[model samples]
Target: MTPDEARTLLEQSLRVVVPDADLTGLGGETDIRERFELDSLDFVEIVERLSQGAGFRIEEDEDLRTIDAIVGLLSRGTPHPV
Candidate 1:
């Protein structure tokens, strides 16, 4: 997928994690953990849902580690297990 598409998906997934939070204008460089108040469970869930939606398997250890890293991974479309 393209970066724009991935970004949109990330925004949508993040909304699921924070339905009421205002994060519409945040850029890819924005730190989600600090900016969106995403806890460990929420982050994991987001990754899980995103991976499922993207038709891939994502692991918390191999996939998600930090907010910046997660953003990079999503934006760049990291390789995943099919």
Candidate 2:
């Protein structure tokens, strides 16, 4: 997956979780936990969704400070145990 592809996936996934929010205004440096009202459960769901879609186990410990970084990591691929 490329960064653009990952971002599109992330945006789509995030939209599902935050349907009322305007995803177009989201910044690359926004802290999802504080900015998007996402809890750990939300993180798990997002990770699961991304993993299933990406064919890789995206780690939970990754620093997801920005959407760019999140997508970048997904594009680069992170090998984790099933």
Candidate 3:
């Protein structure tokens, strides 16, 4: 997937967890957890949703702190299982 595609998927997943979040001005380097006030469970849900949308598994060990990180992971193609 491309960066744009990954970003879109992330937005959709985030919306499921935070319906009122204003993502229009979100920066790529912004910390998602802090920005969205996501608890551990919410973050996990977003990861799962993103994986499903991308048709691949996103390992828990991967660095997913920022939108840029997650987008990079998604656009890199299927990640090898650890």
Candidate 4:
């Protein structure tokens, strides 16, 4: 999928994990972890959801060490490493 498509999926995934969050104003550069106050478990869940939504094994491809990294990975259509 394209970066835009991946971004949409990421947004949906974020919403799934944090429905009350105001994601409408977020952009590709938004720091999800800090901005949403996500913990390690929440980060894991978000990655899993993003993987499922994108039809890829994200956790096995790249390290999602930061929200910027996550966005970069998604934008490049790359998966997060396990």
Best by TM-score: 3
On TM-score, the stronger of 1 and 3 is 3
Regions of model 3 farther than 4 Å from truth: 80-82
- Tens-digit lDDT track for model 2 on 1-82? 8988898888777777777767767777877667778888987787788777777887778787678788888889876734
TM-score of each: 0.74, 0.84, 0.93, 0.74
Model 4 CA deviation exceeding 4 Å by range: 60-68, 78-82
- Clash pairs, candidate 1, are none
Name the TM-score of candidate 2: 0.84
Instruction: Write model 4 residue lDDT over 1-82, tens digit each, in one string.
Output: 6666776777788888889988776754676788899898888898888777766667534666554566667666644443
lDDT tens digits, residues 13-80, model 3?
A: 98889999999988889999999889999999998998889888888788999999999999986755
Please list the C-alpha lDDT of all candidates, in the order they appear: 0.69, 0.78, 0.90, 0.72
Q: Write the per-residue lDDT of candidate 1 for residues 1-82, one digit (tens) a residue.
A: 6566666777788788889878666754676777877788888888887786666766677635444466556656656765
Please state the error at residue 69 of candidate 3 in Å.
0.1
Off by over 4 Å in 1: 62-72, 75-79
How far in Å is the alpha carbon of 53 misplaced in model 2? 1.5
- Judged by lDDT relative to the true structure, which candidate is superior, 1 or 4? 4
